[model samples]
Target: MSQEIESGELDALLPEGTVVRIAGNNRTKWDLVGKKGVVRNAQTLGGWHEVVLEGSTSAVRVQRNALEIIAIIPHSKVKLAGSLQGIKSGDQSSITKRRKKKQSPPMAVNLGKLDEDTLRRYRRYFNLNVRKDCEKDELVFAVRRHFARTKVDESDVIFRFLTRIGKFPE
Candidate 1:
């Protein structure tokens, strides 16, 4: 038996470029529920409409009922705030040469060797729940372990932490 939904309803609810989250009892694909993806195309397939996600090389078809529209990706617009009359011509060669220079790798610090006072200061500044007796490596491990449990991206958390500590340049 066909359980087809109206094409009009699908068109009205999920327009192209609209970001959607998968929501249903499809156990194997539950990992996709919270992840946002842009709608590339929609087509009627048998009893259901299949949606293709952007940046997806495979034409994996997702049923219409599984999708929940979350957001729409906005196009960026460049606005000129001042007049371009006073702008001077820059040396293109210098700009190109600068781009060719290789950046130095970041220096690695031995977290296990940090002093108690420094660790205490970091814990106080970042408002971390790390113990007073914990060494630098232990503190780092604890923070990462907590972050993993919280489902927060480690890179983003580290970036924010660095920014809060004034280690990240503005």
Candidate 2:
């Protein structure tokens, strides 16, 4: 899901205090997905960008794919508009859009974050076809694959309503 923005556009974004959103809810990431934050420094950990969310002290190492440019803070309004040319919120030609790749398997680390009993209970409640004898890793894979088949931002009102209320787990 790596985006291919022009280097000049990206360079304009490397300044500190630039605003950004955690992109791609479908991309494997921490709960920061869909959250916004400010660039803390002009540094990259391999491909990861370091940013700090509001009310958080330490920098969050956001993966490159998870980082979406929102605003360039240091630029004047005119300069900012120029820098962000071609970037539009929710446009089909969104700079964030990349060619659809095969769905990635969910990270096992997400499973590790939950207590084992909770994992089993949720899986059971969801009625996932995973067997009782299956290992936790297998169950994780099965559950993620199942969810991947579901669509996002659709016309189903009930699903959107449930999502708006945070009733469904991300």
Candidate 3:
């Protein structure tokens, strides 16, 4: 989630015609991330801002944190354009779209560097035998698969574990 913004500040900052990206977990009617939209109008409704996305008949009421201003277009220059038009305009021949990269296998974890408490927590959370003499790469692969299945963000989990283990000072 993006940082929260006050209604007054948002109103002042994002006048009509500001181009914004849907950084928050907002899905459009098409069931896709809204991706990009121009601010057609802004209104203060309770604690939320009812913002009208360009080309849409309905407006979405969301907190300031839900909206991220990508570009501020002057009201005079606010033209109804497709979301991808800006990206398509620049150096057409030089631009080449590439397929998404594949995710490599997780790297091996150094169990020796982990303290006893950290190791215990890792075992408890991942339900693995830490004392296993098997390949470290295999353990890492299993842990990665578990995390993927649970939809856990690896960086956040690792950071919390490190902080708890005193690797990162409070």
lDDT values, one for every candidate? 0.50, 0.61, 0.54
Listed in order, each prediction's TM-score against the native is: 0.29, 0.36, 0.34
Q: Quick one: how many clashes does candidate 2 have?
A: 0
- Candidate 3 local Cα displacement, residue 33, angstroms: 3.7
For candidate 2, lDDT tens digit of each residue in 59-127?
777665667776555445222221223334343332353345445686444555666677688688888
Model 2 spans > 4 angstroms off: 1-7, 11-13, 24-28, 75-170
Better model by TM-score: candidate 2 vs candidate 3: 2
- The residue pairs in collision within model 3 are none
Tens-digit per-residue lDDT, 33-133, candidate 3: 45456665655553344455545645565555566665555568765443423422232232112334545688665545555555455656777754555
Poorly placed runs, candidate 1 (over 4 Å): 1-13, 46-59, 73-170
Which has the greatest TM-score?
A: 2
Worst 10 residues of 1 by lDDT: 91-100
**Ranking, TM-score, top scorer first:** 2, 3, 1
Query: By the lDDT metric, which is better: model 1 or model 3?
Result: 3
